[model samples]
Target: MQDKPVLKVVNLRKQYGSGCDHCDDGHEVTWEKNSCPECGTVYACNDVSFELYPGEILGVVGESGSGKSTMMKCLYFDNEVTSGEAYISSYNNGETNVFEESSQQLRHIRNTILGMIYQNPVLGLKMDFSSIGNIAEKMIAAGNRNVEYMENRSKALLKHVHIPISRIKDEPRKFSGGMQQRVQIAKALSNEPPILLLDEVTTGLDLSVQASVLDLIKTIRQELGISMIVVSHDLAVIRMLADRTIVMLDGKIIEQGLTDQILENPQHEYTQQLVYSLI
Candidate 1:
């Protein structure tokens, strides 16, 4: 492990409504789950925090409405945090808080630093654009303008994701679900980012396709050595892809540990149910 983390998040919180004294920080009033029954304030993510080491895949597994996706979105700058700070080792020597950057700086960070692969292909891919075009588009966003270089680079990325050369010019909308995801993966890697955030990347794929995509993810991490944070509800997916895992419930991290350790010796009741259900 490196002495410094590539990404670190501290006390991250995302809420949907203005809170009363009951749901404010350090308030004693509590609710059954994510929402404050009295105030109707939903804590989509509540004081969640974690770190991603260089070349490591950190998995976050949680059921729907568990705040895993919200956290990923916050990290990707898709959603603003209610309060907290995040530091990237490559950006400002990890001294600057990402949540506080300007909109222009945030765009620069998205283009050159962090890559996001959304659960929905529609969210990540330009379905009407050619697969290669989609990849090239990301590079262009990152300020690459040489036509020849972009074409070659796009081809290489699509090839890396196992997209056939014949279909390089085909639009993502015309491709099958699995192929669309492969193209999305290629697009996310177009900028050669140091950190990639995968939000439920395999949720809708067939079992066989899911396995292949999972294999490609593992191969990409090993070959590129890029750090990643994978969010999923599937413990099986996390087990296959993550070096370390965190279990989230009700907008909080209830447990986290090595993937194997969590699988073999889960501590929290929710985590235990999740692991045993795999059997």
Candidate 2:
């Protein structure tokens, strides 16, 4: 890891609904999971903090509703964060808080500094647009007006992700689940962002297709050296891709360490269950 982080997030919090005195102060009052029953407030993400170093993959692993996906959304600006500070080294030299930036600035950051690959193909890709067109759409947002350059870049990226050149002009709707995801990967890379955020990229694929996508991710990391934050509920995925791992439950991190260390000797009960289940 480098001395300076590529991305740093501090005390990120996202909560739905107003809080009551019962759970507002120190959360001392009784609650179920992450919800404060008294006030109907859901603490989807509670003071999450972490860093992504240059050329490394940091995995956030947890079950559904554990806030991992919420955190990813907050990072990508798809969902607003209630409170937090996110510093990107490539954005204003890491001195400015990204969460406080203007919407226009956020758009620039999203288009230039960050690329997000959503779990659902529909969320990350346009089903109606051709695969290359999807990639061109992102490039267009990044201010690329040269048609030839965009076309060349799109074809190259699609081919890199194993999409056939013959099918590059086909709409994603005609592709298989895995092929659609590959096209999504190509589109996300259209901007050449320094940071890539992947949320459950392999969640719904078949076992073999999942392996292919996972391998493509590894190849991207090795070849491009782009920093990545991968969110998944599966430890196996984290174990294969992440340099470091954080285990979350109930919207809070309960355990974290190097993937090997966490797998070999989990410290939390929930983490232990996750590790043992791999057997």
Candidate 3:
């Protein structure tokens, strides 16, 4: 009853193949639409809805094939939602349906309003560019057009992530997985976006490294007052970082509540299983 969220998603749905008779993206059909061909039109995301408030962390959890990543993609506008509305804006009450926005508007929203750290660092960073360069590129793309401002922001963000100043010129491939992840974090923050999307950020890190990264993320979020949606399979990771958590299974939100509540007394069977799995 406080107020509306900075980002709102309503009855969102993403279906694969219901249109275009030829293209693969148009259909959920497998192998030339032969065996179980009628099983086309798969729904990667089904009637999903959520809200993210400024300076809040929401953990999105689900098992494999639960469409967690797909949902993230839809929110990021990398993939279009088949139905429903998504609103993202600085004004808590301002609502602009994402699908209704033009490509340019969506681009502006993506660059300035939101930043995404992908699960795959290779996909997230430029392998050929130095870490600093990659970060700078993002800053520029985010509207920091001045060269000096871009470099300074890039350096600050890299240092903020605890990356050594000396390694600023090193390409992502030259760094360890943990280092690359940090660089990705830096790149994502380069734009000073108010919203951050992290997908399985701790996937490749060891326990100690994961702890360090998590701490760094928390520090940044507190300092920047950035809202976030953390997509992860690890409840411990989510517990350490998220204020609230939502459990998704087979493309539906099965349960949602504060971290302690969900961890202490998960209402749904699937949520209970997930909590128990961490034990």
Model 1, 1-279: lDDT tens per residue?
898999999999999999887778557765869999888989999999889999999999999999999999999999999999999999999999999999999999998999898899999988899999998888898899999999999999999989999999999999988888889888888888999999999998999999999999999999999999999999999999999999999999999999999999999999999999999
Off by over 4 Å in 1: none
Q: What TM-score goes with each of the models?
A: 0.98, 0.98, 0.90
In model 3, the number of clashes is: 2
Residue pairs in collision within model 3:
17-26, 17-27
RMSD of every candidate to native, in Å, equals 0.8, 0.9, 4.5
- Alpha-carbon deviation at 182 in model 2, angstroms: 0.4
Worst 10 residues of 2 by lDDT: 22-31
What are the clashing pairs of model 2?
none
Writing each residue's lDDT as its tens digit, candidate 2 over 1-279 gives 789999999999999998888877875777799999898899999999888899999999989999999999999999999998999999889999999999999988988899999999899998999999999999988888999999999999999999999999999999999999899889889888999999999998999999999999999999999999999999899999999999999989999889899999999999999999998
- Candidate 2 residues lying further than 4 Å off, grouped into runs, are none
| TM-score result, candidate 2 | 0.98
lDDT of 3 by residue, 93-148 (tens): 46668767888888888788788988889878999999999988877776677988
